[model samples]
Target: MNINDLPAEMLIEIFTYLPEWDFLRNARHVCQIWKLISTSPILRQNVELSKYMDSYAYPLKYFSAIQLYIKKLVMHSTYIQTFEKHHQDVKFENLKSLHITSKVQCTWWPNSVFNNFFSMFPNVQIIKITPEFWRDAENCLYALSQFSIIELDFGYYGSNSFGTMGKLHDLHYRFIQFVQCQRSLKILKIRASDHFAEDTVAQILEKCPTLTSLNISGAYVSAESFKISTNALALTEFYMKSQSEFKDGDLEALTKRAPCLKTLNIEGCRSITERGFRHIALNCSHLKKLFIGELDSNCVTDVGSDVITKIAKACPHLEFLSAIGCSKLEDDCIIDLTSSCGSLRGINLNGCTNITDVSFFALADHCPLLNVCEVRNSAISLKCAMYLIQHCKGLTKLNMSNCNNIDDKNDSELENMLETQSRNNKPRTNSSVNSKLDMSSFSMHCFHSHLKDLDLSESMHVTRTLATKLTRILPDLISLKLSISADIESDEEWFQEIFENCVCLSEFKLSTTTIQRQDYLKL
Candidate 1:
């Protein structure tokens, strides 16, 4: 059969797996059949023009081909100028979502520029503008108010300076006006320095009755400011990160109103203590993903095991939890958490040095569906690693960096097997040595094929022999990191053997103390 004899549906399905840029630049130009399949409505439903924005004239050519079929468009600032010069009258009637990103500030453009640009997409329901577009806040907000966008995500990177207090107040007033204009608003995310006042949050909750997701970061939200008159019944996801003024009282008030919240991220909110979590347990029983990591904070002593015990008991459906840098957490809390929340798939306990092997054992005993586990800089021992490998069969990604107890001795079983095989392969005399087999030529079975990403960086006991055994045990690794303490001399052949054994490996990091030779650098 000829290569082109395949059905058109099959060809289209194959082309769907290719990257958008590759389909546009290479696959579409192959033949008329391929071109027609590539430009089909299915392939052109979501178009990303940011890659071609680097060249001034390239995006205009591709835009002409897929403009009518594009339901979602993502373009950079340079494409705005290209469109204005060439295709201003082009109407994207099917476009529902539009994402605009700018490398530099868009202060030079006036409100009329955005108004005219947005007029082309008459049916756009979702608009996401990066922070650089907010440098000219008054004009941008004024232009956005003209349209009734259902979802607005003013990107998380906030302005470094909001000018004077008077200007900030004016900007806040204009922002509120913009929110009031959107009658069907459902999702809103904004990260501006002190941009949302106490009443502003209350006003949004009361006015946008259909709002379901609200993310306000880099702002000061106190209990008084976050207070609302009625319940936010439709709200399900609330994220208020890095709000230093947000205390337990504010969390209590907010969770009381937004009782249906399933995903909450209050990371870096140092003022929120165990009392805040107690409120979450009482009100938000449907919580699934919680990120309360106090990254780099020295004052997280208040969030101890009591907080985790309450959350684990209340929220049994919790799947993902991140408590990074919470130094006060111990093994008891984790044991209680994993034992209760059997549905947990990912947990980040990085920098919690007090947690010992007890937590890992608990995870292995209860959380069979665990996938991603990070315990970097912790006190976990070899038993924890062995238990996780033996019990958690579905585990994929594991980060054990700076874990001093994990050394080459963890692979003692495999080492013994290798020594036995070597003795059997040895030649009886010097004449038969020519037929002797190398260790790398042995066909070792893989113990764990599901694990794709493994990090053992800064582990002092990782020798060349142990690393070679790891390649055989986990042959399907996509990313592997090893910081071996052994010398690097005459190790080029071993590295080549690793690449040959782990055929699917794409990213590998190896570091040693001794200086590497010139030939070893090539591998």
Candidate 2:
């Protein structure tokens, strides 16, 4: 069959996967059939105006065909500035999602431009204002209050300049007014800098009864913030990360109000201890995803294994858990959690230096659905890798960066042992050797075909031989990250071989510790 002989429905479905720029710039101009299919409502559902802002020299009719069918629109400051000049007649009645990206700080827009810009999208329900986009919080909040926004995301960069306490108070008042206008607000993500006080959040919780997801970061949340008169019956997902003032009492109060919480992220909140986590395990049994990683502070030493084991027993339905830099965790905690929570799909145990191969063994034996595993800066060895490859058939993304135990010597030893065992057909002397042989045999045959993303960065012992073997085994890799050390002989040949084998690879990140001029040129 010819390539273009497919039905229109199939063609539209294929074209729908293309990016907004590709579909508008290249795919639509291919042939008459493609052009007709490109004009379909499904293809024109998302219209990004920022990409076409540079082509303002084009006629007004160039965008008129897709304007009416656009359900989501993305614009930038440059596009909004010239919107009145170039596309004044463009109106999208069906637009429901409006994303505004800004590079330079915009304080305020002229009344005429602001009115015309917002009047075009009458039914916008989701508004995403990116970081450093607006400096004047009052103007931004007042303008947004005019629309009945259901989901509003004010990016992490709160206001660049709230010069005085009075101005910050005014911005907070304006934000509360904006939340008051949102009668059906379901999701609200805001960077709570100086703009949100305890009273402000309490008022918002009291007003927005339909709110299900609330993400407030970048500020100190007092224990009294979640203390309100009415119960948050509809709240399900709450993320209060990096709040220095958020303590165990705050978590307990919030859990009492939001009893139906499912996904919670309290990472970087150094004040939250094991007591805070116990509150979650007791109140929020339906939780599926939890992130308690401490990214920044070095003094965070309260998180231990006992509380995590309690959480595992309480929240057995947890699917994803991230405990990055939680150095207090040992093998027993991971073993208990993995054995208890059989449905776990992804786990990040980065910087848990005490975790050894025992945790991986438990993961392989208990968690069959494990797909994404990150064990950076740990004490795992090649035996653990072999076990995961042999058992976890669904494993796709694995990160073993900075793991000093997985080196060229261990790889070579394992290969030699397997080769000798195959030649002699003899029973292994020890149980560990027998287990290694079994896993090695399975790994040799299976080749881990499901893996697409692999990272072995900062492991100085990774040599070319192991890299080639991995590239050949996981041929469908989309992202591969490696770090070069002084011991590796040649970098060019292995990189070329990797590129040839992994045909679907798109992102390749390479770093080197020892930089020689000749090696640099070869790379």
lDDT winner: 1
C-alpha local distance difference test of each model = 0.74, 0.73
Using all chains and alpha carbons, the TM-scores for the candidates as numbered come to 0.84, 0.84
| Clash pairs, model 2 backbone | none
RMSD (CA, angstroms), candidate 1: 7.2
lDDT by residue (220-263, candidate 2, tens digit) is: 45567776564655788888777787888888888888888889
Q: Which residue pairs show backbone clashes in model 1?
A: 198-225
lDDT of 1: 0.74
lDDT of 1 by residue, 415-435 (tens): 655465445554222121221
Error (Å) of candidate 1 at residue 47 is: 2.5
- Candidate 2 similarity to native, TM-score: 0.84
